[model samples]
Target: MAKAPGFVSLKEILTTFKISRRTAFNWLKTINQQLQAQKLDQVVNIPRYGYKLTDRTKKSLTQKIAKVSSPQMGHETILNAHERQTEIILLLLDQEHYLSINQLAKMFHCSRNTIIKDFKALKRHFPALKIGSSRLGHRIISDENSIRLTVYELLLRQDKLVYAFINRLNYSFSQAKELVIKAQQQLHMSFSENSLQQLTYLLLFTKWRITHNQTIDRSENWQWIAQNTKDVLPTCTKLLGKLGGNKELKGEIVFLSKIFLCSQATEVDCINKNLYHDINNIAQEIIFRYEQLTEQQISYRVFTKTLCNHLYATFFRVKFGIPFSSSEVDEIKWQYPVLIKFTAIACAPLEHYLQKKLPSEEVALICLYFGSVNNREYREFTESDKLKRALLAEVLVVCSSGIGTSAMLYHELSKTYPLIKFSLPLEIRDLAKIFQHNYQAKLIISTTILPKGKYPIPAVKVKAVLTKHDQTIIDSFLRQEVPRKLEHNASAVNSLVSIINEYADVKDEKGLRLSLDKFIFPGLQKNNKADLPTLSNLLPAKHIKVLRKKDQLKWQTVLKWGCNLLEQDEIIDQFYFEKIVQLINRYGPYMLIANNIFLAHAAPSNSNKKVGLSLILLDQPLEICSRGESAWVTCMFVLSPGKEKEHEKALEQLVDIVRNQENINRLLKAKSPQEVRQFLLSFY
Candidate 1:
């Protein structure tokens, strides 16, 4: 049979191991560090500068390959270690005649002392083997075919023990503990204080082995002669006795544990054995069945099937339970189809549980608490109801036009505001369909009225150009300070519309707010739904009613809350940064990006005249994204450098006006950014 395929690419490695690039890099670094620390034969003659395993090292690694329980593994082994070790040894022996110890030592890159010890051990195990002295100064030993096979079996057993040892250390603490518990239970043994303490020491010792390459001395093995040893020491001594003393220590448990602890390695040997064995066997079967196929076709068919089988077993175990086995393994082996089918089956549970775990549904339920101030009962935004509230920052936009200009505009907006998703293809004829096609869109913005004239969507209209009047309208969209009661007066709506229409040319914050205030009536009439009117509204045109929405106390609270969530003395992790981006996405229609600052404003459905603070992230630019079910999150805002007064003032105005503690608390609680925007729009 053709030799098994080598690791093809980094992408293949990542997929096989189910590790991120960051994680894979770390593992590679760890391996390099281990190689350097061991002072093993200097790494040489490799394609890249990565550490190279010497022949002995290759043997060691091949032994580890068999254990599929390590965190580094994402597949199952189809062959046992014995079959693999036998094949490798047979290939090696067949390539050379009467190999000498010195030659083997040179290949393995070990000292004569190690080779002598290994030869001595082999001789003791196979007493019938003949030894010969050569004039060429080579130490020779004889092994007939049966003896070679017998030694291969022993090597396979040793490899299995070593693989198990490494796997126990690398997977999880719980897994290691479980193995210990199961062993103890099966043996029906109870540990004394000393034995228990020894186990703890063993755990630490194992950890040290992986981190620092070191070897354990024979004295470090479990002690039987020491009086301090307790809990059936005699039984342990007797068992060790049967396994043989230092001269014949084949697959000793205490020694195996020490090696794994010191090496910080895993059972790759077992995996290599199984993987190769399956490749060989599967290839033979395919070649036998398909008599006319080319070599490439046969190889591809076998390779693909092997990959599929591995995925099926791995994902099956992950989805159901660890330490799992089914009698149906034979059936699966015969009928397994493609890798995609395995992935779908494996991901089912993770996806199912994730949907249930999201806080979006609860946040949606909270939106119900906000009944229309005018008793109009405007429908709240709906979609992604099952996701958690924290994920709401991603928005899908919906518009009347088909996927032409509006969709193009949505893509442009996405570049400026990466947190939000848009549904503006204009392909969606109605708001409900927009919600259905992209439930993840938190709020909707449209250039035209809803075709049905009644929209469940929290819809807002944006002028083509952003003028001063348009700023007022956009400003109203940012503040939930407007009331639905304004719908009763056409003059109020007309005046608000005119002011918004007039300011379509102004983009400045001052110009934006000034033109926007023309639409608000501070003391004209007070309804229970209206927030405390701004001081400017109460004082009328003669006197400005200047109100500070965010005071010193609120700022302090925000800083403290931010610190707590970030959980670091310095900057928080990037996940929180991504969340802030999602927040912006849910709230605003038009946003201005100046370095780190993000500003957005959208109007309410009941009264298009009122606007609310759509969203803002001022502390820092978002630099992280989190994956969520039923959503693709690109919500991150990065602050750049510029110290201009206008920039600072604009940023402060946006933060102070748009992100007060009350508003933030509500926004943060919103199931999606759309909901947050709608809640803000409701204020208008």
Candidate 2:
């Protein structure tokens, strides 16, 4: 009948069509689109009802369906190449026996060559399919579980086929579905609509396999997955009972359960023992590495919950060698080059712990997991964090290079805004190590480019030394975006209250809590490093020696002269000098890090006693020969790192001073060792 216009709920539509919720919605959308194309009135979905078809639309569609049925359904239905390829794969998955190319060609009403082309396309797209043929027929050559995973992938990519796929079940579809629904709801286990449909169909296929005597061997293979599903076992058992499955069929059920486990979650809280104990730690380590690598902060919630959810499935997929539902690693690698590299580095923890490289597809999926986090807005604090910063705002100050740049920023910022709290100078590498708990800092003021990623707090970019314009920008940020210095005013209020109490007594017993809250907040918010080796500490007048324009020295003598100063100063052992000499001898001009200057050094060792730098400047450059090549050295400096990254700031400063022509000229033209040291000390 062409039914009369009326409101109908989505539930009634699902019941009427015997399709999953996702399929029913998709069908409705397709129907509406077709109606719109024909310039006819379409069905309208009502909120409480499913859809309303007025008399005219109902009558129009009835005529349209009749006209389409005669040609499309009554005769051979032609399919596009992509559509036919999908149906062929579906047939291979459904068949218990191998299907011949001739049989598939006849069923789809296509030639053998066309069918073969489709097969070639399938192999080209999915190498994991392992398409094969024998004299008997062609078939999927992999295990049954793998075939099922491919079906899910197909359904995900081509969702319009979902309705037909779920509709063609051979077993007790309605009753088993009822039981599955009851158990899922009763056990508080829920899944995304798409995943629920896929897993339900997977359960049907598993049951079908068992009925055909293709049951999985060694059920203990699934016992490890049992730990996360103990509470859901009773529900699974009831469904297994409905399928006439005994204890032996338990492995298939557990495997089916994993489909829902790995899929996107909706309302169900995904935290579990493995999550709380194992995965969260992995997520934290991943976050640490991302921070260290990106020099930025991310949403902790995104990392701990969203990313934790992803890692849970990823670990199992890689361990079991299942690469279904992965983005193409190559495609993602090209699209997200920087992100992929950072993800690869961030996942080093997992790779080390797993004692193997992550599969390329898994790496891409994990890249996607990190890719989701790149755009998520940083954490926004409530009044509680603002209250913590109300007293003295914690600001992170960082600079581009040298130990003094950040220090210079801190002194200027603190002097200008004395009421605000500030951290010691920070390097670009140190930004991640700060604000492990983000609420501790309210603002970031940097002399360098702070990472452009999701840094939780507001960051202000300025010069190493503050300008009036920079001060104005900081003033605007503190006023507009940050907490005010309101906590300091609380003490003034207490003093005024005390003076008022000295004059008179007041009574407002019922409003005392509110009264005190006006003066005080309920609670205060509760929230490393070796010193940088500076130039003044590392280089002294005694360590700095120079040569005049008339007194040019050989490059070999230049390296030896500077290195012996370090040895006599007790900065390095004799072998340290030999190591430098050996480096220059073995690798000619290897010590020349800059144009016309040489930085002589050996790897840090136990022999190096202190972190220091010794310099020798020459007015006239000397040329040296080794390995039949020649290079010039106007200045020679020897540095013993003593420890790695400990003297980076001093090294940066030294590079800065040598890079400038005027500074080098002043040192080269120096009258004494005292003058050369004084010129270098000015930079500190």
Query: Which is the leading candidate under TM-score?
Result: 2
Lowest-sum lDDT 10-residue window in model 1: 365-374
lDDT of 2 by residue, 448-556 (tens): 4556766777788875546667778888788765446533545745666667677867575335434654435322311112367778778888888877755656666
The parts of candidate 1 lying over 4 Å away from their true place are 1-238, 246-252, 255-684
Error of 1 at 492 (Å): 78
Per-candidate TM-score against the hidden true structure? 0.16, 0.43
Highest lDDT against the true fold, candidate: 2
Q: Measured by TM-score, how close is model 1 to the native structure? A: 0.16
Which lDDT tens digits does candidate 1 get at residues 1-684? 001233235565455544445544544554556556655443333354323445544544433322222211233332222232222233232343454556544443333444454445545644444444464433324433223223322332233433343344444545444444443443343332222323433443344342442322343334421232222233333333432333233223344332222111101122234433543453333222221111112234323333323332232223222122112223322322221122222222323332432122111111111111112111122333323221332333443321122323354334333323333333233444444443444344544444454654355554221234433653355344223432433455556656766767645645545444433533233223233233222212211111123332332233233323223322233343344344444422112222222222111122122211112222222332223312211111222112111122222333343324565544434544444344544553
* RMSD (Å) per prediction: 29.0, 20.6
